[model samples]
Target: MVTVKAVVAGSFGGPEVLALVDAPDPVAGAGEVVVTVEASGVGYVDIMARRGEYGPLSVPGFTPGVEIAGVVTEVGEGVDGGWLGRRVFSQVQGGGYAQKVLVGADSLATVPEGVGAGEAVAIGVNGLVARIGLERAGVGRGDSVVVRGARGGIGLMAVQQAAALGAEVTAVVSRGRPDDRLEEFGASRVVPSAEAGASAEYDVVLDTVGGAEVGAWVSRLRPNGRFVLCGAAGGAPDTAFGEALLENYHKSPTFIAFSLGSLPGPAIVPQAQVLFEAAAAGRLRGVVQEVLPLAQAHQAHRLVEGGGLFGKVVLTP
Candidate 1:
C-alpha cells in the first residue's frame, strides 16, 4: 500500500507530542486534487492545536497544518486535467503536515511563477490574515495604527501592508528583540510592550497577542478606533472581559475578533491574488524567516513556543 510521511501528535501536551511517522496515502475525492506537499506552514495555531487549546475543532493525535504550497500530483474524478503538475497553494482544514494532501479544487490558488514553495506558504495564510484583518479594521491613509506582536508572521505583514496604505503604523514588540526592521517594514514607531498602552491614541490596533494585555489597549484607542483581535498568542480573554471592555470603552470603539478560517473558501483566491500582486510589485515584504526540513517540525514548534522567531517558519517535505 502507498504511504506518506507526516507529523502526528500522538498525545496533547507540548512540542514533544509531535512525531514524524508514516501514514496511508490520501486519495482525492470528486472536485479535489492530491498535492505533493513541497512546503507546509508552521504557525501559532498548530502549537495551540497540539496542546489541545484550540477547542473542539482540533482533536488530539491529528496531523496539524492549515496551509501548504505544492504541485498537483493527481486529480480526482471530475477535476480538470490541466491542474496536473501545476504549482498551487492550498488552504486546508487540517492534514497539511504530510507529504501528500487532498485539496479542494476551488481552494487552490496558483502560486506566482517566480515564487518558491516556502515563500508561497508564507504569503498564503499569514499574508491573507494580515490583509483581511486590516481591511476589516478599515485602515486608511494617515490613520494611526498599532500592530501588537509586530515580529510575528501576520503582524509583520500587516505592518507593511498598513504602511503601504499610507497608514502610520506603530509596531509593538517585546523588549530586547530584533526590532531594527520595523522602520524598514514601514513602521513609524516601535514601542516595547512594557510601554505600549501609554500612548493611548490610535485609529486602529491589530492585535495578535491577546489576553489582559490586549484588554488594556482598549483604553488607548481613540473615539471610533478599531481593535481587531486576529490571534491570541498569549491566550484569549474570556467573555466577561470582552463584555467589560465594551462597556468601559464606550466611545463607540469597535472590537472585531475574527479568523481567516471563518471566511468562505472562494474569498481566498481573490485575496491571495492581491497579496501575490503586492509582493510581485514590491509593495509587500518577505514573511518567511526560515524554512527547515519536515523532520525538524518538533524543533520548529519549540522555537515558536519560545516566541523569539523573526518571521514564519516553514517545513519542506
Candidate 2:
C-alpha cells in the first residue's frame, strides 16, 4: 500500500496540534490530477484554520495548507495526458500539507520555466489576491494607493502589482517590521501603521490587516476612494464601527470585503499563469522568507503566527 506524509491538525488549538502522519495515497478522480507536492505555502489563513478560528470549516483531522507547487504524476480520466509530468501550482480548500495532493485539472497553472516550486507557491496564492483586489478597486495608473499589512505575502505582492499597474504605492507596515524590500517591490513610500492615517490621501486603500483601525483607514480615503479588505489578520471590526464609517455618504466611498475563493476557479487560473510568467521574467517578485520540511510544519506555523516575517513560509515535502 502506498502512503503519503501529511501534517494533520490532531486538534484545533496551536502549532503543537499539527502532527506529521502517514496516510493512504490519494488517487485522481475524474477531471483531477495527483501532484507530488514540491512546496506548500504556510499562510495566515492556515493558522486560523489550525486554531479553529475559521468557524465550522476548521474541523479536527484537517490538513492546514491552501497552496502548493509541484509536478503532476497522474491524470484522471477526463484530464489531458500532457498535464502529467508538467510543473504546476494550485490553490485548494486544504490538503496542501501532504507530500502528494489531488488537484482539479482546471485549477492547475503551469509554473514558468525560471520559477522554483517555492517561489511559485508564494507568487501563486498571494499574487492572485493582490491582482484581483486591485482590479476590484479599479486601481490604475496615477492612482494613489495604500497597502496595509504591506510586509506580509499578499501585501508585498499588492505593492508590486499596484506599482506595475502604475499606481503609486504607500505600504503601511507595523513599527519595527522590515522596510527594506518595500521600495524594491515598488512601494514609493513606507509608513508605520500608527502613522498611516496622517501620511496621505489615497484613491485606493487595499487593507489586509483589519481591526479597530478599519474606521481610521476608511476615513483617510479621498472622496470616491475605494477600500478593499482582502484579509483581516488583525481581527474583524465591530459592526457599529463599520456602520459609522459608511454613514458619510459625501465621501462616496466604496467598501469591498474581498475573498478570492468567492470567484469561480477557472476565472483565476489564467491570472495565476500571468503572475508566474511575470515572476519568471523578473517583472514581479516572489518573496519566500523560509522553507522547512513537512515534518516541521509546526515550526512554520509558529513563525507565521509570530509575524515580522517579510514574506511567505513554505514547507517542502
Candidate 3:
C-alpha cells in the first residue's frame, strides 16, 4: 500500500495528542475522487477534535483536518474522467491532514483561476459558517449587524460578508489593541466585548463567541431582529431558556443556532461554490495568518488554542 504522511490524534487531550504519522494513501471509492492536497485548514473544529469536545474520536489514529485544497489525482468508479486533473477545494467530513485525501465528487468545489491555495484553505469552514449564519439571520442592505469574536477566522469572514451585503457591521472583539484587519474587512466600528453594550442596536447579531455575551447581546437587538449563534469559542453559558424565550417573544426577536454539520448537504455545496467565486473576484477577503508544515500540527493546534491569531492557519503536507 502506498502511504502518505498525516497528522493523527493518538488520544483525546491537547495539542500534544496530534502525531505526524504515515498512513495508507486514501483510495477513491465509487463516486469519489482522490486529491493530492497542497493545503489543509487548521480550524477551531480541529482543535475541538483534539480536545475531544465534539465527540469520541472515531479512530485512534484518525486524521483530523476537515477542509483541504488540492489537485485531483484519480477518479473512482462511476466518476467522470474529466475530473482527474482538476484543482478543487472540499469540506471533507474528516481525513484531510494528509498528503492525499479521498472525497465524494459531488462535494468538490472547483477553485477559481488565480486563487492561491492558502486563500482557498482559509475560506474553508470559516467562510461557510459565516455565509450560512449571516444568511440565516437575514442580514442585508441598511441592516445593522453585530459580530462577536470579530477578529476570529469565522468572525472576520462574517464581518466582510455582512458589510458586502450593505449591512452596518459592529465588530465585538476581546479587549486589547484593536485589530486593523477587522476594519480592513469593512467593519464600521470595533468595540471591546466588555464595551459591547455601547454598540448601536442591531438588526442582526452573529454570535460566533457564545457565553454570558449571548444573553447580554440578545438583549441588545431591536424588536424582531434575528440573532444567529454560530460558535461557543468564548465558552458556552448556561442561560435560562425561559428567560431567553421571554426576551425573544416579548421583544419580538429570534434566536437561531448555526452549524454547518446541521445543515443539509445540498444546501452547503452551492453556498461554498458562491464563496469560491467571490474569493476569485476579490469581493471576498480571507486572511491567512500562518501556513505550517504537517509535521508541526501540534504547534498549530497550540496556536489556535492560545487564541490571538487574527486569521486562518493552513497546514501543508
Best by lDDT: 2
**Per-residue lDDT for 202-294 in model 2, tens only?**
899998888887877787888999999998788886565577466756889999989877876677999999999999899988989999999
Where does candidate 1 clash, by residue pair?
none
What is the C-alpha lDDT profile of model 3 across 81-170, one tens digit per residue?
999888888887778899999888888888888788889888868999999888888788999998888888899899999999999999
The parts of candidate 1 lying over 4 Å away from their true place are 238-240, 243-250
Clashing pairs for model 2 are: none
Two-way TM-score contest, 2 vs 3, winner? 2
Q: Report the C-alpha displacement of residue 184, candidate 3, in angstroms.
A: 1.7
| Maximum-TM-score candidate | 2
Better of 2 and 3 by lDDT: 2
Off by over 4 Å in 3: 56-59, 264-266
lDDT of 1 by residue, 1-317 (tens): 98999999988888888889999998989999999999999999888888887763367779989999999999999999999999989888888889999988988888777777888888888889989999999999999999999998888898999999999999999656448888899999887888764756888989988877776776678889998999888887655656646675668888898798887667788899788777777777667887888788898898888886678899998
Could you give the C-alpha RMSD of every candidate to the true structure, in order shown? 1.7, 1.3, 1.6
